[model samples]
Each structure stands twice: as structure tokens, then as C-alpha cells.
Target: MLASVTGKGVCLCTILWILDTKGVFSLKNVTLSIEPSVVQYRNTSKLRCTYDLEGDALYTVKWYRGSLEFYRYTPSEKERDKRKQAFPFKGVTIDVDRSDSTQVTLNDIDFVVSGEFCCEVTTEDSHIHALNNCKSMVVVQLPEHPPEISVRGEPFDYGDILRANCSSYRSRPPADLTLILNGITVNQTEPLALRKLRPTDYSDLQLELKLSDLHFQEGQLNLQCVAQVSSVYHETVGLELQSVRHPVPEKVSAPNTASAASTASSQTIPLRLFCFTMLCFNAESVIKILIKTIPASCVTYYTVVATPVCDYTDIRINSLDKFYALIVVINLINIKMPHNDNPK
Candidate 1:
């Protein structure tokens, strides 16, 4: 039975459809529409169900969802049999309100249960019926962490190029290199350079820092260098800018050009200064002096350098060719020079 109507005709049809009692039942064109078809994580995704009925005899209607069911009766099921108004909606049902309603709600959603839902309605008019369908899906993603740094080398010394390099050694992805010197930090976009780590075959990453011009201090110098790579963790090793002490020449030898009469003076000055470099002798350190007079008299004096008094003079001007060094700090008085003949 197809009932098409305008304004007044629609009202009349509604009244007749509601008042019909003894007519044959033929349920057809039971079109259903649900509100939402998709959902989000932890959010409530549901649907609003609606339908279009065919004839007046299609009174008793039932709606079946996935596994649960519900029903609504016409002409007031108050007079109908108790067994006739049975609803498929019990404990595991949803949206059980309003006539011509067939909506279902998905509660407490996760990544597991994302699929389609059906809205099946049956008219108990001993004839035709209709239903509808809807579906939804949920997606998930993971998180990530930033990078870190580290360092390597034998040791550091004064005048040694304190070679310090920067590398993103241990990282999931190769790191973007950065450098932090003193108090300033270098960004990644700059033309950063990292020397190839020249470690032994069995070693890890290598970074170099060359810090020179170590001062003449008593204790260790406090210096440091760190490597900063984007994916590499932060690491630093205290560079103890060690003082590199060179070997000081031993006792000053006599002037090679000086003969028995003319004592060497100018040439012996440079030789004496060489002994001041670093004096470590006989398991201890001692300072030996090379004294020269302006009149061309040069002498090597082995005495307590602090005490000008000659203590135990080993060799000097007088002991020429008689010692291991061909020169000594002995008292060689009367050693005169050739006549210069300059008038005063």
C-alpha cells in the first residue's frame, strides 16, 4: 500500500495509518538511516536510526543490531499480547528511545574493535520488512625521542693540538652534529666539520682537541672539550693541559774557540743558558752557572747556584782537556787576552 500525500492529505493519512485495525499487514520500504558512521579513540561514536514505512498494517516493528535487538509496537501495544512487544534489546543493547529509532552506540573504544554495524528492523505484519548498515575504523601511532653525544682520545699536553672532535656516534638515526665551545653553542645549519676518527682498528669513535701554549704553572691547568651531536648523548672529558717539559742540557762546556790565554766570553753565554732549560741530575735537580766577564773571561762554576761562593768546583778555565767535558769551573787566574790597542 503506497500512500503519497500533500499537507492535509498527510494528516489524514497519518490518522488513518494510526487508526487502522483489521487490515492485512504488508511491511515494505523500511529504509533506515543512522547518524554517525565512524568514531575516534576514547570518544563515543554512535548513530541515529530513522525509517520510512509503507502501509498502515506494518504496525509491530523490531530492530536487530549486531547481536542485540529491540522492538516498538504501533496503535499502542498496551492492548496487544505481552509476547508480541518483545524487544531484542536486553542487557547488551543501546539507544532504546523514541519511535522509529534504531540507533546504536559504541562505548569505550580502542584499536581492537573497529568495524561495521547493522540496523535490522522487522515488521510483524506477516509480509515485507527492511534494514540498514554503517561502519567505522580507528588508527594509532607511536612516539619518538631526541639524540645524544660522546668522546675519545689518549690524553692532552701543552703545545699538543688539543684535538677534540664532534660526532653523533651512538644514535638510532645518524645525528646532526653540533659544537659547544667555552660558553657558546654552534647550530646545525652552520658549515660544521668532523674529522674522520683515526682510532686503531679495535677502537670506537675519535674526537680531538688541540690546546697549546701551556703556561708555566705549578699544578695542572683546567681545560675541557665536549662533543655535541644531535642524536649523540652529551659527554665530556676534563683536559688536563699538561706541561711538556723538555730535556735541559747538562753542565755548560768551555768555549770551543778560547785558547790558554784568551778566555772565551760571548760564545759561552748561549751555552750557559741552555743548562737552564730543565736540570735533572743524580736523581735530583740542580742549577749550574756559566759566568763570563766583559773582558772575554768565561767560566763554568759548579756550586750551589743560590750561594755564589764556590763549594766544590769540579772543572773550570784551569782544568782544560783534563776532564770528560774538556772544560771545568776551576780557578784559572792569570788567563789574559791579546792586545786590542784601543786608546781610552
Candidate 2:
């Protein structure tokens, strides 16, 4: 019952004997291939069914979503009619016009459409009947929104500790999460990270980066968190340090030398400028000048006085041993300097 073919006939007694005894002539090979086995919701997918028939006796091809048959093609009829085709199962949609005898196309697929699919072929013949089936798996990944980045620190600055967290919208398959700082990958080993699975079939990923004694480059550094559902699909967020209080660099000199006094004198101008920059401005104010000096050894001492449309007066005190306050009712003046200065 083999079909007519254009092949050489090797009519050997041993081959014929083995084929008859092992029932090899009745076997057929069927294979089904699905494109983009993993996909996001609302995406298109294609399925192809192929088989090698030993004999062509009105073969029928069928496609199934799980165990439910959704599409079929009969070779006996030249044109497939739409009126007699079977309806697709609930939550599944297929393009009947585009699908052919060996192919199935699903459009606008969603999370509910993910499942096992089967392709089957059967031939009609009394003595030489043959049937074959093949199965494949498909998964629908959910799309996630842009990731969110948050920082847990106050007055961000160098030589400080901080933590950053990046989180994405709920998604299936637990979006692949990564943290990159200055274009370098940060992993769980470097920072204590935590990952969790939600009860809603979603994923939650988090990373905790402990940056102790933050570096100078880190001030201008960029931190980014990226989450991906697939190779071509993902979201990212970036972070930067904010302005904060920073310790000033100290300039010291050798003890009992002329250079020591000169160095301290040159450094006082810039120190006053630094203090002026840190002051907070307000509208309603009275004149307030407070000067406190603690000279450990040999160091230069300077004083700045500010008057606001009022009479000028010079005030002096002997020692800053105890608390003292000098209040003026109309002007405000402030001088900035280091808390303690020692030469040598």
C-alpha cells in the first residue's frame, strides 16, 4: 500500500523481511514548530505542522490548544469553507483565513492563551491507516511598566552611607533585574540583595547597595537599575547624589616656623568664603555677630563685622571660656571658620 514515488527500488530479501516483521512501513514522522516559544502579552505567534506520510490516502491535519481542537484542514476538499469550521475555545483567537493546511496563526495573544499545543495527522485507509501527533509549549509573558528607583539617605555626600532600591510593576516570570553603577554591574555578592515571589503569580526583585565612605568619583557617578521581561523588552531608572554637608580640607604646617603663620593667614580668606556660602537667608532679621576662637598653638586669628544701616561700634571680649551672646536689634552678620585650629 505504499504511495508511488520516484526512487530506486532496492528489493532485497533481508530488508523486505525486516520491514514486514517490525511494522516499519506503517510509521510516520510528524513535527510541530512554534515561533517565539516565549512571548509578551498582546503579541502575535505562528505555529507550523509538518509530517511525512508513507501513503497519501486523503490525509487530515488538525490543530489543538491543549486537548481542545480548534482548527482542521481536510485534503479531500479543495476549498475550506468558513460556515462549517469549528469555533475556537474560550479565550483563544485564531486567523482562519491566513491559516492553511500546515500552519496556524494566533493574533493578539494574551496571558490566557499560553498553554500546550498539539498538531495531529491522520490518513484514511482500511489496511494501511497511519496517525501521528506532536506537541509543543508556549508561554505568554506579562508586560511591565517602567521601573521605580528610590534612595534612603539624608544630605547625600561623599564619605557617606546610602541605599538604593529599584522596583518594577507586577509581571509574570519575575522580570530579570540588574543594577549598574557608572556602567559597572552590581550583584548580590557585593550588596545584600533580596528577591521575592508574590502570591499573585508575579515577581518582586530588590537590591541593597551599601556604599560606606562614598568616593569622590561617586559624587559625579550615575546609578541605573534595569528590569527586563525579554531581550528586546525592558525598563530602567537612574539615580544621583544630592547636595549635603561636607567636611572642609584642613591646611596644617610645622610647629614654631614663619611659614606656619603665613599658611594660616592665606587659608583664612577662603575659609570665610566657605562659611558665607553655607548661610541660610531670611527676610526678617536683627544684627547678630558671634565670634568664637580656639587657638591650640600658633595660628592667625581674623574677625569680620557687618552693619545694617545703623551706628558702628567695636566690642571685644577677653576669653571665650563660657557661653556669651551679643545681640543687635537691626543688623545680621556671620563669620565662618573651623571649630579648632592648631599650628604644628
Candidate 3:
């Protein structure tokens, strides 16, 4: 009886050890990796599942998109053609040629595919060990063009108010918009506005800046608008601001009455001429006086008189009365009577 009991106990311990070993070698470290977590619409993506099954064989590798099974891989299938399979699902197209138990290729993904994706693995063990991992993906419909920035109150002047607006349109998931002024971000005091159309969305942001001396300290203000959709898309538009300042008025002194009168008299004088003859007169002296007092256009002709004892000249003067008075004084001082050998 003692021998039989001891043998049975040994067998029981062996069975327990085998069970513990099997449990220890079950599935572990199951991880799911989805490339390009942010995917553009109608683009391809790849998902991979990695697991350490110890010494167990892979029973099935199944992929789920939000609780719906779309792909399955079973190595234990008797028929080779039935081992890998794909199910029809909206927005999910599997590339069967490049898919296997470890990884799956997704083609032509769209907005409907943006959600949690799970990978489940089961081992061919008596205990049917299973494990699953899930990750998220986002599909975005990018805008055809970058965000547009516009200013309402342009040609800004000091102490004026400036208004600006930024717009991003036609995106499935609306892009975020930011307004920056001179490299500094401008806070959005106004509420953001959204307009949704079929298959796309639009976003708009407004900003207001008060023009002051501080804003124009650097001579010009720089404004920018940035649009972003996660890490997939980014665009920027910028504008420059300058303030217009009016020029200061200059001072003017009162006019001089005496100078004004003199200028008026000179301009209003009537032009005229007078002829004079003198004895023992210098012809060159008379000619010089006439040229200074008369304009060249008014003078018709001039005659110089030469005598045995004196020289004289006939001069025509076309000038103001002040100039004629000056000529009479010169004649009195420069003329010398031909020494009257005969007294008259």
C-alpha cells in the first residue's frame, strides 16, 4: 500500500508540473502597430501585430475594425487557399497578396475607416490561449488649398482699429486656424465659426488688433494665419502692416510791408526811353548805362557822336521811372561842357 501511494503521488506531481509549464508558455507581449496613425483620405495604410506565443502554434490571427471582423489568418486550415481570408466592409480594402498572419495591408482608406483597430491572436493549445491589442487611426480629407487670410480695415493708421479674417474650407475634419501678429500669437476673442456641407467642413477665425504706437515700434507689423490638420497637413499665410501718419505743418512768418511795396512798384512801372547828348562825354560810359537800364528787346538802335573836342551818344532807355531818374543824375555828374572857347 505504501509503494502504491508513493507512485500515485509522484504521478500527480508530474501532471501538475506539466500544467504549470503550459500555462507559463501561453501568449504574451501582444502588441499592435498601425503605420501613419493619421492617414490621408483614399491612401494606403499598414497594420502589424506582434506576439510571443512561446512554443504554441498560431491558431488564428484576426483583425477587427471597431468590433467588426474584416480579416482572418489561420495557419491550421487544411486547405491552403482558405488559410487567409478577407471580408467585405465599407471603407476597408485588404490587399490579400501582401497580407499574412503577422501583418495586413489596407488600401484606399477613407473617412469611414477612422476608428479603433484591434488585432487578436489565439494559440492552438488545450487551454486555447488568446490575446488582443487595439490602436486608433484617423483618416482626414485635406483641403484643396491652404487657408486664406484677409484684412478688412487695411491702410491702417495710428490709433485705428484693424479687423482680419482667416478661412479654411472643404476638409472632412476641419483644420485648426491660428492668427499671429509680428511673430506673436493673437488671442481669438471672437468665437470660432464652423460651416458644414455634405462630405466636407469649413472653419473660420476672426481677429482684431488695435493700431497704436507700440504696434508700430518696429515700423511694420507682421500678421500670419496658419492651418493645420494633425501631423499630416500644415499651411501658412502672412501679411505685413504699416501705419500711416500725417505730416506736421510748418510755420510761416508775416510778410514785410516795405519789401512788398517796393516789389509792387518795380513790376507796375511803364517802360519808356529818352535820348540825351552831352559835350566831352564818354561814349563807352553812356552805352554802359543804357544797357543796364533798358532791355535788349526794346532797344531799336544807338548812335555815337564824335566831335573834334568831345564824344557824345544817343541812348534809348526803356525802363522804370526810377531808372530814368538814375540816368539824369549820371549825365549831370559825367558831362563836361566843351570848354566854351565861345561863351554862350
Top of the candidates by lDDT? 3
Q: Write the per-residue lDDT of candidate 1 for residues 1-344, one digit (tens) a residue.
A: 34544666889888778645322233334444433333333455455444555443334444444554444445445554442444533232233332333444545555444444455544545444445444343322111232233333324345554334433343221234444433333223232244343221111233344544433234344333343332223445443333444322468888655463234332222222222212122112223333433222423332323333323433333222334332333333232222345724
Superior candidate under lDDT, 1 versus 2: 2
- Please list the residue runs of candidate 1 whose C-alpha ends up more than 4 Å from where it truly belongs after superposition: 1-35, 57-100, 126-344
Q: Residues 185-304, candidate 2, lDDT per residue (tens digit)?
A: 764212212444542243344555555444335345567888776455567788765534443346785588655655665433211211121123222222222222223321233333
CA lDDT of each prediction against the hidden true structure? 0.38, 0.56, 0.74
Off by over 4 Å in 2: 1-29, 53-58, 82-84, 123-144, 154-159, 187-204, 212-220, 230-232, 240-344
Between prediction 2 and prediction 3, the one with superior lDDT is 3
Cα RMSD to the true fold for all candidates = 24.8, 16.9, 19.6
Better of 1 and 3 by TM-score: 3
Candidate 2 lDDT: 0.56
| lDDT value, candidate 3, whole model | 0.74
lDDT of 3 by residue, 23-74 (tens): 6456899999999888989999999999998888789999999989999999
TM-scores for the candidates: 0.26, 0.52, 0.62
